[model samples]
Target: MKIEHLTVQGCNEWNEDALILNERERIYGVLDGATSLSSAVGVETGGYLASRIAKEVFETSELPAGCAPLRSLVLMANERIRTAMLERGVDVNDKNALWAAGIVVVRIGEHQIEYAQTGDCMLVAVYKDGTVRTVTHDQVDHFDEKSRLLWERYSKEGLPPDEVRSRVYETIKQNRLKTNTSEGYAILNGEPELEHYVEHGGLNRIQLSSLLVLTDGLFLPRKSGEPTPSMSDMVALIDEKGLSGYVDWLIANEYDESQQGKYTRLKVADDKTAIRIYFE
Candidate 1:
C-alpha cells in the first residue's frame, strides 16, 4: 500500500492527537484525544496520555499471528486507559474526570479491509467507480451540532470570544457527561461499557480505490444554516487538493478578529490528523 499521512497541533499547547501506522502488521489509523475540562496532568494532559498510550499499543504491540482482530486491540487500549487513570488517581467512575479519545483503525489484507472505530474518528472509502462512502459513523455529529448552534447563537449575539466560550462550556460539559452511553456517543474513555459501543467491519479490498482515515479536526467548518459537511464533499476536496491542501484551507480561514473562528466550529483550532492509503 501507498501511505500519505499528517499530524499537526492546532491552538492547544500540546498536540493531543496521534496516528498509528504499522506496516509489518498492515495497520493504520488516527486518534483524537480530548482532555477533561478541569484536567491538568503534570507533563502531559490526560488527553495526550490517553491517545499516546493507545498509539503505543498499535505501533509496538504484537497482534495474533494470522488474524487482525482490530477490536481486541481497542479493548486492550481501553483496559490500559483504565489502569493508567487509576494510577493517576482519577475517578474512573466520573466520566468528567477521566480522559477520553475517539479512535478509528484498520488492517488492510489482500482481499479485505478490516476496521474498528469508536467515537468520531472516521474511515472513508473511495471506490474505483468514483463513488465515496463512509465506513463508520461520525459519533460526535449529533452533540457537535448542538454545540455548534450554541456557538453560533452566542457569536451572533455579539458576545466576545471569551464570553462565548464561557457560555458554551456548560453545554459542552453536559454533552461530555453523556459519552459511552446509550444517550451519547462512543469513545475509549476507560468506561466499563466500551465493548458495546465499538464499531467493527470488513470491506472487500478489490472494490476500493483508497481509504482515508481522519480525526474530526479535519472536518470542514459549516455555518449554522448551511448543509452539513458530507463524506462526498470531503472526498471531493481531497481529490482536487491533497490532504495538505485541506489543512491549508482550514488554517487560512480558522480565525478572525471578531470571533474565535467560524461560528460552526466551536474552537479557534483543533488537532489535525489524517492518513491516506492506496492499495497496491
Candidate 2:
C-alpha cells in the first residue's frame, strides 16, 4: 500500500495541531490540541505528548491482527503524561489537564482496517463501490435527551443538523448538566474520556479505494453547511485532486483570517489538515 498525506495548522496564530505517520506499520494518526479552554485548567501539552506516544507505539509494536492497539496506546499516553507531570514537579491533581483529540486507523491491506478515535477527529473508509462509512465514534457531542431537545429547538430555529452538535455540546457544558467537572472543558475533571471503536470482518470486496482522516478545523460540523462531505465524497475529491491539491483547496477556502463559522464561538479556527491513503 502507498500513502498520501497532508497537514496544516489552524487559522489561529498558535497552531498546536500535530500529526504522526508510521508507514512501515501502515498506521496514520492525527492529534489536535484543545488549547482554547485555558480557563478550564488544561494544557495543550497533552496533544503533542499523545501524538508522539501513539506514533512511537505504532513504530515499535508488532501488533497482531484483530488486536487494536488504541486502548493500549491511550493507556501508555496517559501514564506518560502523568509520569512526566510528576517528574516536572507539576501537581498531578492540578485542575489543568492535557488532552489531544485524535483518530487512528491501521490498514492491514486487502481492504481490511481497524480504527480508534477520541475527541472529535474522524476517520472514514471509502470503498471502491462508493460506499461512505464512518469508522470511529465521537467521544464528545454525544446524543442524549437534553441534546435531542436542544437539537429540536435549535433546528426549529433554522439550524442545520450538523450545526446543532456544537450548540448542544455547549449547552450541556455551560449548564453543568452533563457532569463535566470543569465548567468549560469536558475532558477536564474527567467528564470526557477516550473511546475506542473497532470493525473487523466484512471488509472484503470493499477495496480500500481511499481513507479520509481529518481534524475538526477542516470539517467543523457547523461550517460551510457543506455537509462536511461523506467518506465517498472525500475519496472522490482526493481522486479528483491529489493530496497536495486537496491541501491547497482547504487552505485557500477555509483559512480566511476574518472568516468565522457558526461554531466559531466554541471552536478555535485552527489550521486544517487531512490525509488520504490509497491502497491497491
Candidate 3:
C-alpha cells in the first residue's frame, strides 16, 4: 500500500489546517478548523496549539480501541488550547470558547478502519471493488426553511461560528458551547456509531487507489451550490481516473480566483487538504 498527501494554504494568511499519516502505525488524521486567525500555535494562535498538541498525542498514543484513542486526543487538545490561552493572557473563562473540530482515522489492522470526527472535514472510503462510501457524516446545519429562518435571525445579531453550531444542535440538551457535536454527543449521550469491517474483505480483490481526506474549505455547504460529492461518487471517480486524474480534477476545481482570500475574509473558504492512499 502507498500513501500520498498534500497541504495548501488555500489563499489564507496562515495555514490553519493540519494533517498526519502514520503508515507504520496505520493512522491518519486531518484537522481543518482553527482556534485563531493568525497562526497554528504560540501565543497568537491557540487553535494552532490545540491542533499541534492533539496531533502529537495521537501520533504517540496507542489505543486498545480506536474510539478511546480519539476521545483522549480531543480532550488533550482542548487542554492544550486552554494552556496556550492562559499563557497568552486570554481569560480562563474564554478557554472553553476555543474548540478544534476534526476527523480522525485509525487503521485497526490491514483489514479494518476506525474513525471519529466532528464538524466537516471528511473521510471517504473506497473498497477494492471500486465501491465507495463516506465513513464520516456531515455535521452542517441543514439549509431547510426552518434553518434558513434561524440563520437569518442569528446573522443579524452576529453569533460566533461555535455558537451557531451549538444552536443547531439545541434540541439535544447538552450540545452547548465549543463542544464537538458528534463526539460530544457520543460521550454525553451514547456510544459513537462504529462502522466496522474485516480488513480489505471484498476490497482485497479490487485495486484501491485512494481515500481522499478533505477539509471544509475544498467543499463548503453554504458557498458551493454544487452538492458535496457522495461516497459513491468518490468510488466511481477513483475507479475511472485513479489518483492522477482525481488530483488533477481537485486542483482544477478548487483553485478558483474568486474563492481566493475567502478564508481570510472569514467567508469560510476554510482550508484545503487532500490525502491520497493507494493499495498496492
The number of the candidate with the highest TM-score is: 1
RMSD of 3: 7.6
Model 3, position 218, has a per-residue lDDT of 51
Residue 245 in candidate 3 has what lDDT?
A: 65
Q: Write the per-residue lDDT of candidate 2 for residues 1-280, one digit (tens) a residue.
A: 6666666765554455556676655667666654422233234354444455544555565755444455555445545545554554554443344333344445454545655555557777777777777776445544333454566577668988568767777665443332222222222222223222222222443656767777656652344323334545555665687767766665555545566343222334455666777767
User: Could you tell me the TM-score of candidate 1?
Assistant: 0.94
Candidate 1 runs further than 4 Å off? 255-262
Query: Compared to the true structure, candidate 2 yields what TM-score?
Result: 0.65
lDDT, candidate 1, 164-191, per-residue tens: 8887888888888888888898888898
Per-residue lDDT of 80 in model 3: 60
Q: What ranking emerges by lDDT with the best candidate at the front?
A: 1, 2, 3
TM-score of each: 0.94, 0.65, 0.62
Worst 10 residues of 3 by lDDT: 186-195
Better of 2 and 3 by lDDT: 2
